[model samples]
Target: MTVKVTARGAERWKQGHPWIYRSDVAEEPDKTPGIVQAFDRKGKFLGQALYSPKSEIRLRLLSRGNERIDDFWWSDRILVAARRRNGITATAWRVVHAEGDALPSLVIDKYGPFVVAQLLSAGLESVRRDVLEAIKYALEPEGILLRNDSAVRRHEGLASEVVLAHGQVPQVVEIVEDGVKYLAAPWSGQKTGAFLDQRENRNLIGHQTKTGGRALDLFTYHGSFALHLARNAKEVLAVDQSAEALARGAENAKLNGISNIKWMEANAFDLLRELERRREQFDTIVLDPPAFAKTKANLERAVAGYKEINLRAMKILAPGGMLFTSSCSYHVNRDVFNAMLADAARDSGRRIQFVAATGASSDHPELLNVPETGYLKGMLLRAIG
Candidate 1:
């Protein structure tokens, strides 16, 4: 099948974007889900794309220039992505990052001997056998688990499921990050067990933490930040709304043989407000909430939500305390997030200094052309009276 894209779509693709909207096609190929060659309006070859009739993104280009997406191509792609992270010193890391690796709609995160994969698009989902074969041939992992539960698959008309494609996966796979051991309950915890993207951010916060001081970790899923901060802080309070995640965090803390972390179950928004009312102060604080804006329509609410938490957190910060904040919402761009922080700082009447800016770990590489790949943005700030 061959797809003829409109001028706008062709230009976008030529400029390095991967997705071609359904409205951007001059001629649609057979209404089937599989690989298709895309061409410009002038009949020039654009790229080889995965075409899905049901998706709003009619085509997701897999290759640029003269390239074939064959079995060997798939295997080589996975290998290249793996080699890119050769220097990443961790037992768990993202091997394939969908568009970040030019493999659209495919995510593979390695967890020890087990690998968890998510096929988020019909195009990638259609080649599951080949992908699994490639993964096995390239990584030779003990197990491959397909965690295809993302809501985005609905746009591709695919059902969400979790299947062990290669071998059995342990109930909880143990992974080490920055010398801290964590039992990642795959497909059960948030976003492929734990927020591997925050590995570097957590380490930075741990280093910035003041010794023998109190620390607060908001939205401390699985206690990653809390455990890291525990190394420096005398007492750490880890709070999250999910009881299961709190339990997992406790388990992880135990796994690391550390007991200074105090787990609290509460909604982060309400808890932040309550802590403000009680005048609770911490020497260090971390705000890592979930994506507040899943869509553009929710941007306003997301901004408000972000502002509320940052304002509250800033108010409770002790003088000369350190703050680590992050926004995972791609809709909330860097400028908007920074502006919200600025507003929070002004309203809270505190002088803040930017210490460092950080992003996702090396494992989750971001494509410069595709801004969506850089969803996790964070900063380290110091509060002064």
Candidate 2:
């Protein structure tokens, strides 16, 4: 079946943005969720797209021309995404980054011999078999696990589930990233069992860490940054709200044979305030908090939260110290994030230098045309006075 869209939607596709909201769709197909040809009001063929009736995003363009979106087509796309990570020295990385890879609403992350995938749309779920086959053909992985428990699926009228789509998937899979060995929990861990997007940023912080200095990693989920900092820092404090996550971080520290990391379970915001009150200081600090703004409605609150933590961090940072801060909230754009940091720096009464700006790893490519695909943005700073 073919779907018809308004001129706005047609123009959006022409401009390289793949999503067409429901308000822009003129005619809906009679069929259920699946692939459908998209046409403009005057019957001009726009492209082929995945159609989801229940989702606000009515169409996600897959191709500009008429082409069969079969297993072979998917295999070619998957191969393209995989090829982009050729030089990455990590055993675990994102194979397909949803809209970033032009495969909207689909995410596939590789963890050693196993692969974890999330089909986050009704249309993508309808073609699950084809995607699974393509993944097998491209990666030749030992197993495939569907981590389809994301809340986004609820918007598409789909049930949340975790099914082993192919062979066996172990609960814990060990992966190496930039010479740091750690474990990924594909079955119950966060975001496909690990935070692979920050792989490169972690390495950068590790390399910038001063030897024999003290380091603090707030919101240290699994202690990825702390483990890296511990390699050089004389002592490192890794804090998180989840005790279970801290337990896993301890295991990771043990896996890497690093003894300088101290895993602590505490509220990161409160701890930051307490550390500042006590006049405590650290030579290096990392602020990698969870997304404070999940939507546009919460952006104000998110900015406040970011400012509080960042201001507190700057207050306790030792002179000539390094600070690595980041925000994964897409609603908080780079400009807003930087402005917030500038406010924090001014309010903290510290002379700070912007050392460098950072972004997601190469494996998680951000399409220039799609701003939503570029959610992760960060900065490296140094306290000069």
Candidate 3:
């Protein structure tokens, strides 16, 4: 292990920058990938690393302290972070959240007894052995799946592949969040079969779904919102573009022996407008769309999408109805999301009484400096026209 950081990179390290780019290096040739080492500009000790010359993130700073970046430290930190999460007993949750957990560009999602580990950077992928060993020892999950399917892999010059590392993952995973049971299909579904980050948001907004309320859920992927709300609401109308998604929503509803849910496959934008045109109204509306715009460059269009959906939701909202709107785009901050919601409220000619502002589950910790981890944002607002 040998390397040196750029002249002022040590300053960045001091300030808790979770990543070390290739430009940050000043010396030392790293022949092998995933090798942990320490270096400084003037031959002084800086910190240890999980090194990868192929990655833009060259080094995952394992420790700023003098401790080695070995199995003991990795296992300890991973468990410490995992223990902080609230409701991950026998279900899936983000056990290790990459940079937020100080293991840069690596995400470990525990799905039921199995775990899905994603190496989003070449540097972290370099330390596969240590990472896998840590999970095996600390978490002791049944199976470990390497879900390296993120777009970040392309940027790092790595190919996408999914493989079962040690054990086998079930096609279906049953998880209970806030007493709300969910059966997730990991094989042909969205990210590891569930949006675990929205667990807190889903549970929080359930209080608003009173009995006999007509609830409309747009982009209701897998019925997390629509199905859960049906427990209390009179009827739950879930809309999405994919028929497969709608079918799964229906299947999930049946799996829970639930009724009073309408799984509709349609463009949510057009459906919302149609509902407004027909003067149809819902007691509650939820907008949990996919990431419209991934990067900051397309933030304007993403904001437009949010504003449009939110505005339509407000239009069809019954008088004194609640609107639970959310955006998963990290580029769209809370301030911007709030601004978009306010604009939607004004467009609907309704006074927006904001009840609560919420974020992702506690398991997905948000580092103040790393804004990307603080992506999911939601607001519970009631419209009084």
Candidate 4:
């Protein structure tokens, strides 16, 4: 099967864009869903892609040139990705980051001996067996679990299911990050069991805790950030609506033998507003909320939500306080996020200086050409009264 793409699509592909939307195809192929040879409108060979009939993204280009898309190709790609992460000492790290690793629409995160994989695209689903084989041969993980509960799978006409692809996975896997122990239920937990992307950010906060003062960690999932803050703060408040997550965070703190953290189960927005009204203050504040916008359509509303939380957070920070905030929405680029923070600071009447700006951990590498891979954007700021 050959996919004929429009001139615009051809230009985008030539510019290294991996997706060819349905509207971009000059003519759709009549064959079934599987691999197809992608060509320009002039019938020139452009690349090979996985054709997804039901998706808006009709073609997910796998190779840009004459490269073959065979079992060898899959094995080699998986091997290369595994080799790149050999330097990562942490047991829980992203082994393959979707397009960031040139394997678009597939994510693999390692949690100790067990590896959790997400097949988000129809293309990856078509080659599921081959992918599993490649992963087994390359990494030889003790267990391989498929976490296909992503909502995006609906667009691909695939049912969401979680199952053990290989070996057995414990009810909860224990992972150690920077000396902090965490219990992650990857099969049922959040994205890939934990926000492993925040590994480095948590370490940074742990180091910044040289001043033993009060700290507030809003939207603190599993209390990862709060535990780190507890290392330096005399008292740390970890807030999250999920009682389960707060319990797990409390358990992690107990595992580390740290008891300074106070777990609170309350909606972050409501709690922040209440704190602001009470004129409460904290020496450190961490805002690691979920993605406010998953798509461009929700960008405006997401901006407002981010601005609200950040504004309230800044207003509640004491003088010379440290604030670490992050946005995991790909639609919210660094420039837009920074601008939103600026607006929040201005509205809150807080003088702040961005001491550090960063993104995901090294294990989750960001490709310069593919900005979507750089989804996590963070800023460490100092509030000056």
lDDT of each: 0.89, 0.93, 0.81, 0.89
Q: On a 0 to 100 scale, what is the lDDT of residue 8 in model 1?
A: 95
Clashing pairs in 4: none
- Per-residue lDDT of model 1, residues 50-98, tens digit only: 8888999989988766776667788998999999898877788999989
Task: Assess the local accuracy of residue 376 in candidate 1 as a C-alpha lDDT between 0 and 100.
Answer: 90
Q: Candidate 1, TM-score vs. the true structure?
A: 0.97
Tens digits of per-residue lDDT for model 4 on 238-344? 99999988989999999899999999999999999999999999999999999999889999999999999999999999999989999999999999999999999
Candidate 2 local lDDT, residue 370: 94
Sort by TM-score, best first: what order? 2, 1, 4, 3
Clashing pairs in 1: none
Best by lDDT: 2
Give the per-residue Cα lDDT of candidate 3 at 106. Answer: 76
Off by over 4 Å in 3: 36-38, 86-90
| Backbone clashes in model 3, listed as residue pairs | none
| lDDT: worst 10-residue window of model 2 | 81-90
TM-scores, each model vs. reference: 0.97, 0.99, 0.94, 0.96
lDDT of 1: 0.89
Model 2 compared with the native: what TM-score?
0.99
lDDT of 4 at 307: 96
